[model samples]
Target: MISSAPVIILHGGAGYWEGKNLDSVNSALREASRRGFEEFRRGSSIEAVVEAISFMEDSGVFDAGKGSVKNSEGEVEMDAGIMDGKTLSAGSVVLVRTGSPIRKALEVMKKGKHVIIAERKGNSNTTFNSGKGGDTVGAVALDLEGRIVAGTSTGGISGKEPGRIGDSPIPGAGFYATERVGVSSTGIGEVILRVLPAKEVDTLVSMGILLDDALNSVVNKVSRMFGKGNIGMIGVSKYGDVSAHFNTKGMPRCYQNKEKIQCLVFDGDFS
Candidate 1:
């Protein structure tokens, strides 16, 4: 059965190896999910998404914010996005040099005048002490009032071209939300851009496809075209159906679908 209460899910990235001493990774994921859900109780879905992504960006354990990987020019560029399911409104920033990319994304969303913005200058921040492997951070949540939201943050693919932007800042590509569902994706930005996985999942779910089936089909489709180790996604429905699926070896997450990195929120169970 679908849940009507507040709920949230998050991901650190789509790659990992077994027995890699993921203590830091697991701790950060748990903290983000727990804190994000608390934000939901106090505010709404969008707030929860923002709070969680922000934390991950700062945690330095992933490829976003403080720990964002360096591009080919040995520069750090970042991307972030947010979407409101209740209104289909969005905001995003690309090639940002600031560490607070999530806040910038929120600013764009709040302006309601533009869907995307770009940046090329302004470099501030050093890598976090624990920041390491994970390449992106994403979240999806359903609030107590039925609002669903999705958001993502990334430091861009390591060794990418200096000014290149990925799916992270593209509305339907990296993140998407509608009245029925909210989605956030992490993977090879270029491939994700072509498939627009987030939007695709929203379309399928709206067409009466069950959540699991919809996610499964998308993963299968991506696998057929791009092979594995390319994508990971997390989502929440208005009625509180939560899911995480990835085509990569694994993604740091809080749900068990064959394998999961962590499960700290909602009592480690999904309704």
Candidate 2:
């Protein structure tokens, strides 16, 4: 039995933000969810996903579009991705500076032949040597029209090497959606890229696996496969089943549906 209204889920990031209070992070997640649900009620899954991510990006509390962390050279190199389930269309942008990367991802999905832009030459040599700032923000929403959309934005890791590209702007790596499911992810860009955890979750769910079972099983497998690196994700099925899992200290997250609005900093399984 599904609720009458739509459902939206958001994640501030997957790793720890040193010295920051959970209350403040929880507030940002709550505000983001509330704002995004407004758009969902207006019947636009696309707008809902963007609006939700925009709130977190503007909050400056998360490492996303505006307040993103700087690279080893102290420059901001951002990545973002978005996917619309109904149309099976997606977009992404990398090494971007200015405005919302999520918005640019949408434009890319609509206009470009390529899935991603500006191919970086090599992987960040410091992927495993990161110190703070691995946060990425994202949202998944199932709109009133039964459309599911997913989007993610990130500033990359703090002190990362310049030209270091992560999973955030990769379609299946950081975000994915289909008529049945939508997924968004955060954590160590290197591991997430290797695992493509978001797309894996959607793939499992499409195989008729239960949403929670699919997410938990895949996340655990990814953690085992990677051996090291934080990872967290949020997913929503078209029927409004929602779940989130993080293999880290905490993941600032929030969820809103017809029944309630809940926000929390998860240090445990919050599915």
Candidate 3:
């Protein structure tokens, strides 16, 4: 019997983290993992993933939602995506200006009619920031029922062209999930978009690849193609295994299992 014990993993982003104040980043991941696991314990992976990401979106610690960077025109725009492994159902939103881009993504998923939606912006009375510190935020979860779900939310790179959408809202590019596994990606959206790291991991895992090896292979493949510092991923398998890999100097991340939760930043830097 598949143990009802749930597992979850998440990432802030892939970027130079050799030196930078990350107290807030670490705290956010820890809190997210704790809250996400609680939701997973009683609900579905979908709920847990959403609840976790929604917190980060409003945390003002990452390049999403409140912490979204401005475009060349100086306005906050964001993108988000969520996927259900059991039904292969997914939803995404792009170029939106709101305090809860993750919720908008969830709304699109529940809508069923459209898998993706775009917006010029929203009139949410929310404050914006320079988007200092983080890059993107994402999560992958395996529920007690063995179902998996993955989701990603991002504000894109700073000073990007207006209406420019990255991999965050694109299935297979930023996130993918199957009954067997779930994957979420962060870092250089353009580079990530080129290789579809999330889907690649799913394909490799389905083909008998170990979750850890598949995650590493994706990073190696991306590193070879685009060089290092361009990719990071988190994965959760139906059997409750989890993995995190990235080529950048740092990818703030954490994972929770039956044992415990560990949050990390620079290599060897554990909190």
Candidate 4:
């Protein structure tokens, strides 16, 4: 039988939005927490975490769903990915709009045959372009049933040229999950593309590094690979160990839960 403990993780993205309204950020945290705990209470699988986060991704409140960033040409492009740890199944979508790209990625994983990559198109209704304007967010969750899933959604890089798709919708970069570990990320898309922080972290854990140390290594590597940009991630091990890390001046927000829930915001000054 599976353990009664469930875990959920969330990220708000990485950037220089220091003076932005704190209330809005708090509200987003509340929303994320609500969805996360609801899934736990229902004894749902990791899929429920994806469904709950998809609501946030589609809410236009944070930066993953409706208010995501725009490219250099002022058009919105999106990316998303999902992975199921138990089955090693994964799916990803890029450069489309309409339905949630993360959801589409999960569908692809479930279908288990095709690799779905949304091509860049002028029309913004494709699954890849649905949540431009910084509306993109990423998630990783493990349910009481011991199922794990990871997902990410993003509106491309800020000021990016039209048709420029980042790694968030790509597996291994923005999100990754396995029976041994779970991962999700947020930060500069271009940087994320190069380092593939989420998967790298998982690899470290597999190599016998402790979960917290593994996460730190990935965060430090990201900082070394891409200078000055913020990157944050959360991970949970098969042993129920939880860890999170960030390399920027400030990481907006991150949360986790096993028995009780906790929310963290790392702003500049470490106070």
| Model 3 misplacement above 4 A | 1-4, 122-124, 268-271
For every model shown, what is its TM-score relative to the native structure?
A: 0.91, 0.89, 0.95, 0.86
| Candidates ranked by TM-score | 3, 1, 2, 4
Give every collision pair in model 3.
none
lDDT: the better of candidates 3 and 4: 3
Evaluated with lDDT, which candidate comes out highest? 3
Tens digits of per-residue lDDT for model 1, 1-271: 2444577788888765456557888888888877787785579888888988898888888899987888787778889999998988899998888668988999999999999999858765555433355778999888778898889999988788888989988988899999988888988988999999999998999999877677778988999999988888888776677787787766777632112224632112343
How large is the C-alpha RMSD of every model relative to the true structure? 3.8, 4.7, 2.3, 3.9
User: How high is the CA lDDT of each candidate model?
Assistant: 0.80, 0.81, 0.86, 0.68
Model 2: per-residue Cα lDDT over 1-271, one tens digit each:
2333488989988876556767768888888989999996566889899999987777777788667888887667788989999998889988876667788888888885878876343433322212233379999999778899999999888888888999888878889999988999888888888888888888898889977788788779977887534788888888888888877777788888867887767554433
> What lDDT tens digits, residue by residue, belong to model 3 across residues 233-264?
88887777777888989889988766788888
TM-score, candidate number 2: 0.89
Candidate 2 regions with alpha-carbon error over 4 angstroms: 1-4, 17-19, 119-134, 268-271
